[model samples]
Target: MKSTWIALLEAKYKNLKAPNYSFVLDEIGKNPYAKVVEDIRRGFSINEDTDENTDISFGYVLFLAPGRDFLLRISMIAPYAFLAKIKERGSTSQPIVRENTQDAMELDVLKILESHGISMFDEKSLKIGVPDSGKDSKSLYQWMFVDEEIPPWS
Candidate 1:
């Protein structure tokens, strides 16, 4: 079955022109199809255009710790920000939440961004954090937000 997050993203931006993907491609380097070895790893969607290259679909993040395939519900709680619980593929079950908020799904994503030098917010600022383009963090943020601003949540 199609991922709910992906579907919602597609539905919302079906009419907009596609975004430039070479930006992300430049980051992943020649190994677009990098080998998958880690049992649990973080990945950004780039193979499929609609997954991350759309004009508004800023990011498509996946986790391989327990499984792959999940995303923020497309309904943004704040401008350029999306948050919601995630269910297993094809199962309308409860969201996967752990006792430690640090181990939370959202944290998983933030950590990946952090690894790339993106805090997702600048120090003492509410605006969406700027990323190092050379690190291709800009592309990742592009996949995360359509426009930069103080996320409504703050």
Candidate 2:
């Protein structure tokens, strides 16, 4: 029964957040793909919440490079989808100087979604979202990624 775009992409993958990979691992510090990465995760092929009332949505940011199976998905003009539609019609009309309101995707208004036949973004079935502890993902990536809508990344 879980199909309103997989419950809105598992409610944005349980609001996933585990970002700071030390500035892209210090710019892949020595760039041998950081000596065969064994970890780094956040992947969801496509999430096109294409405006019923315009809250803004688009996709492509999968960087699940575990062990160099690599997935440097890109296509950004995002600045957080118009500040996540101004934090859903009301929140940050004032306080934000780009430390990260989660949408440095600027304002593409939800393009590049390539229309429902979908394309690319299967860097070999990547799925990594964790937080049911480690202090509930330390603030807001309260994870569970869909275990029969599991909210647990089953």
Candidate 3:
């Protein structure tokens, strides 16, 4: 039987969605890793031309373990519209902005999981780089370990 934590995570992903975009969930059950990837492709209109809409692909991968440990990896490929906005604001500021945004988003996700009694172990923000898609590169963030009991504050 699936544990309560697993059930909660599953329910959360199942209900997750974005406006005007559908999500796809891919479940991977392998040794030492029971993972679920939730993906979405969002369309943005950068120009008045309808044919110029760009699609941004992003997703989160959730890793479940046997005990009270879990991991989440988030990847986002910026759309042309988003890149344009960043460029308009000054291309040099993109890295800093992206890092801060990813950190904020990771914190939010951790908070949600914590509300379910999950404690964080380790967290990391991967360096941004080009993805196989050949579009804009992606920013990756990962959080590892989810415990049922909260750790004592130092």
Candidate 4:
């Protein structure tokens, strides 16, 4: 299954000529295949035009393993910028709602970008914060959003 998905992504990358792209893969709370799971998730991001001479686009893919086959979801985030925010809403409790804000930080994101030879200035470039749920183990899903300000020129 992982091979099929990787092949599909490679095919898409070859067929689509987008200036930017990103991918994310989730693999938490699932049994290990061969070795211990070093990372719970992975992701990638790409930006070709630094001068704004071309359309800015981005893509992301995620995988979730729920005791069976892994679940994968790929998304293309267009109109890319330097900073972005992702929010996760908590369920209703005690007449209060919890809102968590963050940016994309799946490790695979950087790997994918590097695979395409895309350069990033610093590791701090991607800023994402996951809320600390009451439970010891909690899965937090993030809704990605672009920042209002222009990305800093590097």
Q: How many residue pairs clash in each candidate?
A: 5, 13, 0, 10
lDDT of 4 by residue, 54-150 (tens): 2122222223222111111112221111222222331111110012212234234434433443333221322322223332211111111222122
List lDDT for all candidates, in order: 0.33, 0.23, 0.23, 0.24
Candidate 1: lDDT over CA atoms?
0.33
Model 1 CA deviation exceeding 4 Å by range: 1-54, 66-69, 72-85, 88-100, 104-108, 121-154
Candidate order by TM-score, highest to lowest?
1, 4, 2, 3
Which stretches of candidate 4 lie above 4 Å from their native place?
1-55, 61-87, 90-105, 121-147, 150-154
Model 4 sits at a Cα RMSD from the real structure of 18.2
Q: Write the per-residue lDDT of candidate 2 for residues 1-154, one digit (tens) a residue.
A: 2143234333434333433212223222333221111121112222222221211122112321222111122211111212122223222232122333444332111222222121222211223323333532321111111112221111
Which pairs of residues collide in model 1? 58-142, 58-143, 58-144, 59-143, 59-144
Worst 10 residues of 3 by lDDT: 76-85
Evaluate model 4: give its TM-score.
0.21
List candidate 2 segments past 4 Å from native: 1-20, 25-83, 87-108, 113-129, 139-154
The most accurate candidate by TM-score is 1
